[model samples]
Target: MSEPQTASAVEEERHASWPELFFDLVVVAGAGLLAHLIEDGDGWSSLFLFAVAFGAFWMIWTCFTAYGNVRGDDARLPTFLVGMAVLSVMVAAVPGIHEGHAQAFAIAYVVGRVAAARPWHGATVVVDLPVIQAFTGVLPWIVSFWVDGDAKYLWWAAGLTIDLLQLLRAREDKLLEGAQERLDHVAERRREQLAAHEERARRDGAEAPAMSARARRRQRRIDRLEKAGRVGRQIPTSIVALRTDNVHLAERFGLFTLILLGEGLIQMLNAASGAEWDRMLVVAWAGAFALIVALWNLAVRHGSAGVALLAHGAIPVRVQWVAHLVTSLALVAVAAVLGVVLAHPARTLEEHEVLVLAGALALYLLVSATVHAVLARRGGGVEDGRRAAWLAGAGVIAPAVVIVARESLSAAAVVCVLAAAALLVSVVDRRARLRLTGARDGRAVPASTP
Candidate 1:
């Protein structure tokens, strides 16, 4: 005979499990290797290399996330999928195999996603099946047959776009689920509070000996209204869950920034390997890489902190996810630019490329800082905004100065400027930390008081 269930047992089954962390190790290794390979390639080849590498990365991540969505609390399915994705990434990494082996890669990816969807069987499963079939079966077959570069790229973009949309839809579903749970909790709490109030009123009325039966009945009605009002006062738990999710997403942004920094360093090493190991080139390479890392840190620290704070308030999950996705994309683009700069510094900073690369980098920094500043301003205060604005202004101005002074300034001067920026940012970061600590400890003097 089956054991009798309790309320706690039902609740226990509803709580979601955290996704696997250690399983990402192999995927990370595969991506790093792919980045290395891309760094080794030239011109259009590099673009092709990046497309394949990033596609592979996204595929692996998407599959894992899909599995988590369907069988999050089940350890067996996720573990098996992660192992398979790791193997698929490694196989996709084979040089020259990207185009020819596209079918196999697609099959592996499709199987991973489809298998994960097994647990999600029902009405909604049908909606996802067609998209999966297009990505894994039809798109790959079509792209493989097309010998032309433009056609292949077009197909790849379309397929990847669909995959991204699916991911977004999944996130939306999670947001809705959290919202529903919060609403339910609020209603339940309100009902409990109303019940308590009604009980108190009923007791008071029954104890009054002079009260008529009609008066007692009126008191009962009043108690019911009070209970309803109490029930209505419950806090929406879904909003709270969304906020928590945002904070987690913000932290993910910080992690991605670190990944970009690593990419820059890898590119720098690749560049140095090609040139003479002279002191000047070494200094330039180190300075440039450090500057990139500093810029990344500046973007994420302020941005993520702001996101974390705003997430504590009642913001919509959709808005938060949009902001997070944009920031993540910008970070990736910046990293790609830095990789190009490091890999082909001479070619990159040349007359034709300099204008575009420098401008793009400046624009990205400005936008990133602005978004973070806006979020920060809305949450805690304007301090983060001031800091972000200053950094952005420097990012814009320094590139211009570098471009104009290219002839007049020595390589040492360029290196010096980059080094100075990094140092200045580090110092400012430390000061901010100290000030925050002082305030937390009650050791800080208020501006008005001082």
Candidate 2:
């Protein structure tokens, strides 16, 4: 049995405040607008535009999420509200990008990101701060305004790509710095132990343990390290100021997933209400609802293990950040596709529509699978590989299902197929988890167990 939680530990557990929940409303609206934009557009150009806009918007959300995770209840409500306002402007500009709103979009993105960067305003060190690195992409986005035609979008893509590259690099730097800090602390403790031994021996009139040449060199190096104050410099007050509440951070991401699902359902219902009533449309709606339920269960139930891995230093926090980012994009893409399908359930699915839906589902499963696989490899003590593999296997099947059925299936049939795949994965994953738990408890539980 686990130990009981103490009052201090209970108090330390962070939770979402009202301001943060209010901030999520902006995401709901923004997701709906972006989905509508996609549903209304055609060809590769619109897809490209969506990519750029989504990147900027995603980074903005991440900035504020990170701020809240770091600051907890102390996070400034006014700053989040301001970020929300700018994000709304950015979302509104997305639909009018070609109608002289491109500049407005660009300006809003820059301002929104800067406002989101408020949490890291006075940082003394830049090594571990991916937010600062993410800001590097803003320059190109701002510069895109002066450029003409499609060439301008290239700038936007470049900016977003730069932001991703910087995030990855900063993640590596942080991991290395963290490892070095642990090594330095170990050496410092050894040095102190040796000094204490010598002092005690002298006081007791006993001969101290003889120091080897290697030991002497180690001590000398540690002495120089102490004098140089390298360890002190490595640990800056800024890190404390930016201390993250890992569980709360995970909860925030989970909440965002729910918002995406809720928005998707809203869009589906709205489309259903607008469309003529039909059996196939109802089937499609049912499948979509089931899909949303499966996704929610998967996110809320299993996602915390990955976050715990992040908190315990088994994985870099950036890994979690990037994973969550990709998951968000995929969820939005799924929502957009579902909205289109729900709007015209009687019609045959378009090739691009099939591609988007399959790709989004596959992306979500693959990303989640990868995170869980990492957790298992890092010794989280659950046999996550089977679940990870099951999700990945289902992910792999999603695109193939589309490829084989694209010519024959109705839109509703395709959706139902995907929903069935998701549900199967969820069921199999849960059983595997239960089996693992029972085995760990020294029981031979039936595979038929829930």
- Leading candidate by TM-score: 2
Instruction: Output the TM-score of candidate 1.
Output: 0.56
lDDT of 1 by residue, 91-178 (tens): 5544544456544544555455555445432212222112332234335535544444445545555666665565446553453454
Q: Write the per-residue lDDT of candidate 2 for residues 227-295, one digit (tens) a residue.
A: 664332432222212345666767787788778778888888888888878898899888888888777
Residue 50 Cα positional deviation in candidate 2, in Å, after optimal superposition: 1.2
lDDT of each: 0.49, 0.72
What CA root-mean-square deviation does each model show from the true structure? Answer: 15.5, 12.8
The runs of at least 3 residues in candidate 1 whose Cα sits more than 4 Å from the true structure, single-residue gaps closed, are 1-21, 33-56, 62-73, 77-87, 90-109, 119-148, 162-257, 270-275, 292-296, 299-348, 351-364, 373-380, 403-426, 429-450
Query: Runs in model 2 with CA error above 4 Å?
Result: 1-11, 119-129, 171-241, 304-314, 375-382
Query: How far does residue 159 in candidate 2 sit from its true spot (Å)?
Result: 1.5
Give the top-scoring candidate (lDDT).
2
